[model samples]
Target: MSESAASYKQLKEEFVSGLSGGPVGEIVAVTAVLPIAALVWCLLQKRHAFFKPYTALGNVVDYLLNVGAALLAITLYANSAVLLMVLLLVPALFVLGVPPSTGARRKKPKLPPAAKSYNSNDSKDDTGSSSSSRDFDVLSTKPFLTFFRGSMMVLTCLSILAVDFRIFPRRFAKVETWGTSLMDVGVGAFVYSAGLVAARPVLKERAAHAGGRRAMAATLPRRLAQACRHSLPLLVLGVVRLLSVKGLDYAEHVTEYGVHWNFFFTLALLPPFVAIFQSALKIIPSYAALALILGVTYQVVLESTDLKAYILTAPRVDLFSRNREGICSFVGYLAIFLAGQDTGMYVLPRKINPRSGSSNATQRTTLLMTMAIWCSIWSALYFLTTDYKYGAGLSVSRRLANLPYILAVAALGSLQLFTYCLIETLCFPEFYSAADPKAEKEAYNVATSRVLRAYNRNGLAIFLLANVLTGLVNMTVPTLDASPLASMAILVAYSAVLTGVAVTLDAFDMNIKLS
Candidate 1:
């Protein structure tokens, strides 16, 4: 056979071989099993009574169910089963259920004049509080959903990096992989979702200060200063990693972040950039629009120039060419972060009313409906953008962080939040009221909350630990050559160690907060 025919034959073999079980199968199998286990546990807990959605047991079941559904959807997509992935929508909606509302609203009794006067005075005092006091308030407010998200982010990062996961075909050509791949979505989602949480406080504090020209000017410098301070450690680490054996082979570098350009550098710089823009424009940039513009510009630039060629085959790895994706993708990631900030604006508030028994139910239902709508819209847009001629169809590209990829990450993150919200509202409604010390204490005592809080408290540390462990594993073990079972065993062991460390640190109040 001719060389061209041989090449084609090899490509066909690769495509066929790539369809086998890997991390995607493992995750899907686990997702399918966990819900069933949770259901069984719930049933055992409610031996004589019907399962109560508002009870702790019910909350556990709900959490498991939602997680399983989301995982199943993601895994299916990763495996190139787009139809099965789409079919998950119906069940996700059914599980999400309808929002329940009480037709009657409770009337608040009027306070005595003296009491009213005291409340007014308290409000004035709060308004006049120092910035430190406000910061403390922000620190104290640890929503369950936020904790859940942080934990999930850590878990997803581990799953992608620490194991032999099936990578979907890069494009929609003759290769047989479906929708957006998990590897592509993981890091972007992690960064963007975390950014959303981080931005809330900055925006809130700015609004509180009645952000004007002077405030904006002051804020920019402070944000820049903070960015520099945060970037220092990441820079040091990046340099160290690059100088070390890990950087010897360019192909081994998962993200060009530390080795070529630092993602932390991008992340650190983005806040100040956003702050400056917001200050100048006197409006927050629409994240969706920004993402669209950035993604399109990136595609245009790639198609219009030899930039792609330079990126792939530069004479030597340099700051610019080696880190082209790292640098260009910053805008896309920034847009994602901003979009996350918008999401945080909607999700961070505590909407459930403890006085209403059905409030939790209502909140869960609303989240489900909202996530479903957004997911569908994004999915449709993703398919619509497919350039069949070029064999590119919204495949998740961490390097590009394109529109479809952003939407998919946002949708997945939203679904994860919905699951956490269901658990928090149904199982521990009072947990939402951070202002109530008694409720907060009670909520913290719960087993689930304790584990989540542990992860939340030391999220950064846990992430760093995973990175270190991954490096160690790579150096010590033949990861690529290991059997699937062996790889998974290592992953499980790594995660367990990380979790144990996190929980122990939490117990000792030893959180490693880089920022």
Candidate 2:
């Protein structure tokens, strides 16, 4: 047999041999700790660079706590009673309605100049109501939002687990149903709409931050130039992948559950448009408005018309089968992702100036409130959608910034960041700086440093590696019908192994490009 066949045979044997719980347990064990170790190594290498050991250590602790978030997602995916309970409990860290203790109350602050000026301007108006001209100030503390974010993060991670492990098979079975088709289109539309909304804020923020027309033009030209530079190589890779021997004939096998041939296509085509959309958020009255419009409209289209059948059944036919339906479906989902980001931003601004006299207790309370809100949402959604299996609809970009697949996206991003933080504290204390120097170390008057600088710097690289690994694992793993425990074990192990390999390869100045 050929080398590839032989490798598959070996993997199969491993699978059979690991039928008991040992392999899966070990896999989880490695995932649970290796990340922390790797983080420690990264930090010590950078320890001499004006870092705060204690603060760095704390960051690491936060990161590990974040890993607990993965359990929330596993529960969502597994839909097991145990997992669900975990999910429910995890969000208590951020829910809003939970009783506030004396330790949790935030003291109100005297209005800062920015707020005072705005109020004075408001009072000057004869009608005292300028809804259209109103400028909503970014809050120093978004207690409600914090909870929402924390809950969403947990739920999102859980969703990823569900999609990958196929825990809730009954929900997944809906893939064969007409309702699934409608849901797909509706979800797709929602994702796309949200993306458009989210883009608005980003664009506005950039435009405002730009010094002047000349300055803005300078940045635009450079950004555009950068895009142009990247495009050529990406195009070439596409062409080669299309004709190469390793090509999987994705078009011919479009119906396969785990096929991920179009990630690059989706990533490349959608972002530019989404960026433009995000800029428009500044003009919109509310990001939620955009989400509602898109969701309602998509729902109407899917349910009230023949769009679903045409998109799903007809698009699969030979003449129309160039993956048009799949592409369309994803476009819709992009809207959802965009919307989620926009809503998130609206609720939680990027910049927050803490009240000068605010007590630490208040800050902690705010954090808990955010966590509580997040938990409630997860719990509610869980109960409501127990029988629903959206079946990894086009809404989820799989691993990359999925939109309507809100649960998965939130969990993964939040927990991933949390884990990253944890590793820094526990394994790599050196990298953690009490003050993030890169956040303009001597900025106007900020006290704390940003949480993710280097990680953000290398984010694209890390994300690409993760995506490729996930794709490869899907391609290599045994069929979904494989033994349940075996499948979960292999997936967990595969994810850990690929992540390790990717990080190591990155360290060595060697990177693998996914086709």
* TM-scores, all models, native as reference: 0.66, 0.48
Model 1 clash pairs are 80-178, 257-261
Error of 1 at 44 (Å): 9.5
lDDT of candidate 2 over 196-294, digit per residue (tens): 234344544544554243334324445445444544544554445445413642112243111234434454554454444434556766544454455
TM-score of 2: 0.48
What lDDT score goes with residue 363 in model 1?
A: 58
lDDT of each: 0.49, 0.36
User: TM-score: which candidate is best?
Assistant: 1
Q: Estimate the lDDT of model 2.
A: 0.36
After superposition, candidate 1 runs with Cα above 4 Å error: 1-118, 121-144, 164-179, 210-218, 246-259, 262-268, 280-285, 303-318, 350-377, 387-396, 433-435, 444-448
Model 2: which ten-residue window has the lowest total lDDT?
442-451
After superposition on all C-alphas, the RMSD of every candidate to the true structure, in Å, is 9.6, 12.7
